[model samples]
Target: MRETLAKWRPAIDEAIADLIPREIDVDYLESFFGEATYEYDPDGLQRALSDPIWELLDRGGKRWRAVLFLVFIDAFGEDPAAYLPYACIPEILHNGTIIVDDVEDEAAMRRGEPALHHLYGEDVALNAGNAMYFLPLKILTRDPANLPADRRLAAYEMLMDELNRTHLGQGMDICWHNERDVRVTPEQYLEMCACKTGCLGRIVARLAAIITDQPAEVEEAVARYAELTAVAFQIGDDILDVENSLGRAGEFGKEFGNDIREGKKTLLVIHAIEKSDPERARRLQEILQADTNTDEEVLEALSIIEDTGGLACARERALDLAAEARAEIDGLDFDPGTVDKLHEFTEFVIDRDA
Candidate 1:
């Protein structure tokens, strides 16, 4: 999986660069959004938009969502290279979500550095983040693929539906963490994952299907697989947060025990609260509810989660979802090599350390 990702990463990055370049200028603005009524301030545009945007993009990301988009195209029997530009849609949008999410989460770090808001101010970061949400739409309007009008419309509509669901999921997450009394069920957490993390993958699948002119059934099958893998990946991410905090593994980009600090009711927390003795569970809840926690409090929360089988259960859940995801593609008539890649992709989602 790493080898495959390495081989494709450069190409994926190139495709994204084409959509959003290292620099923004008057000509670029005119080309994308049309000429200004008055005059365009290229210098101001570069300072405010391009500089900060590229600052984050330069930090490494796996670009896996874009790769998934291309993989779907290949699986559907199209030349992925021919439709590479369209693949940028999900990658761009995913980054946008994280940038905005960092601001909303009051996150202190991203990709091993200060969050965008901290460096660029909330106003600039928010605008730049929101700009990414709309930037991908230019791909459709520009008609880079010269897609038929109906296909373009289908892509637009699919993006709208999926993006809306993402916010709904975010809303659920915000609400769950805000109230001390609200206990998020495993089922509800899964639903949130499906809506938030899974929707981006769904966009990859459904867009590939739409552009390839595949039937609805084919779209549905691939979309289900995509959603499952995405949710499994998210669950794995949540588990990693706990593991890293407990010093069971090397640190990743995120701050240790950040979820516990934020009082996020991750599946680990949910399972731990349910299985623990009342006192232990109450203590765990108290740690989660606290406005701030010291290293000792975070460690205590980690120990409770581990003792109550939260880590084990969450790991099992992630693995189970990955298997289900792989199963979805087992019967499909995709390219054999691509099917193998998709299987590897599912495993990578759960087994990845970062």
Candidate 2:
């Protein structure tokens, strides 16, 4: 796996290196928020608000989404310059949402520092999220010196639709917080992840390809690639929540075993619930509902999940979907070099620890 990633590193690095804007338009991002931020005496609302946006930018994640966008666009024969704004639109929006989500989840830290909301207050945290939310639109409109009016309008329309869907997804996530009907089938949960997590990322990747003037058929194919890989990414996240022990740590803003506590319909939980003996299930339900499901109790549940086929099924499903994505990439009209880098990214998604 390391060798494969190493081999593809150059193209992937080139693709990522190309995404950093030569000169960005920061003013336009804040323009939609209106210049007048409410007067604040203490707590440093302005500085706190500014911190998350820059932290989000410099955090330097995998940069996979941007890389995917650039490759898909290039495959479709579009210049990187034309598609970059669209790529940044969703990335910024995603980061913005994460800022708010950490607050909602009460996450203590982001990128090894106290969460924005934890340091600042919820009010400032929310504003920071809103500001990051419009970054792409600002980037698009602020610098028309380079683009024609029609193309700029097209970019805004596409970005708006994606942002709207992302909001719906986030709403669903919050609603799931106290949901009792944890009986959603694997397929149903996949649908949730699709809309909430995978939907925008996949759609915009292809949207970037289309903006580059690639045929509609090619764009659709690339979107499929994004869709398949997204499930793997989501599953990886589920695994991390269980493995990343909040108890041993000094702080974790989000609740440890939050998925179990919130009755999140994860594959492990769902399958464990389904397969446990009836008496065990009844006890499990009681334990789940009670306020006293201790760490030891959650560990028992984890053991049950592992003993049953739930964990195996999830791992198999994630890999199967990733394989499907790999096949789609092969069928696309992209260069072998680009396709190889994409495979590395796919592996990265399934294998991510955090």
Q: What tens-digit string does per-residue lDDT give for candidate 1 at 1-354?
A: 567677788888787777777787777888877889999998877777777777888898988887888888887878888888888888889889999999998888888889999999999999989999998878989887789999999989899999999999999998887889537889999999999889999998899999999998888888999999989988998888887777743442336798888888999999999999999999999999999887778888999999988888998999999999888898688778888889998887655775
lDDT of 2 by residue, 1-354 (tens): 345434444554342223322222344223434454753322343365545466555655555565567666666666654555555655666677788888887777787677878766788788878776764556566543366676567566666665676667667766755565555567766777776777667755755754565566776677778877887788867766665643333453445666666556676667777888876665555556665567666656656666667766777877887898899889876777778878876786545653
Lowest lDDT 10-residue stretch of candidate 2: 15-24
Off by over 4 Å in 2: 1-48, 81-85, 142-154, 240-258, 290-292
Off by over 4 Å in 1: 248-256
Alpha carbon lDDT of each predicted model: 0.86, 0.64
Model 2 residue 31 CA deviation (Å) reads: 9.1
Top TM-score: which candidate number? 1
Summing lDDT over every window of 10 consecutive residues in candidate 1, give the lowest-scoring window.
247-256
The number of clashing residue pairs in each candidate reads 0, 4
Candidate 1 residue-pair clash tally: 0
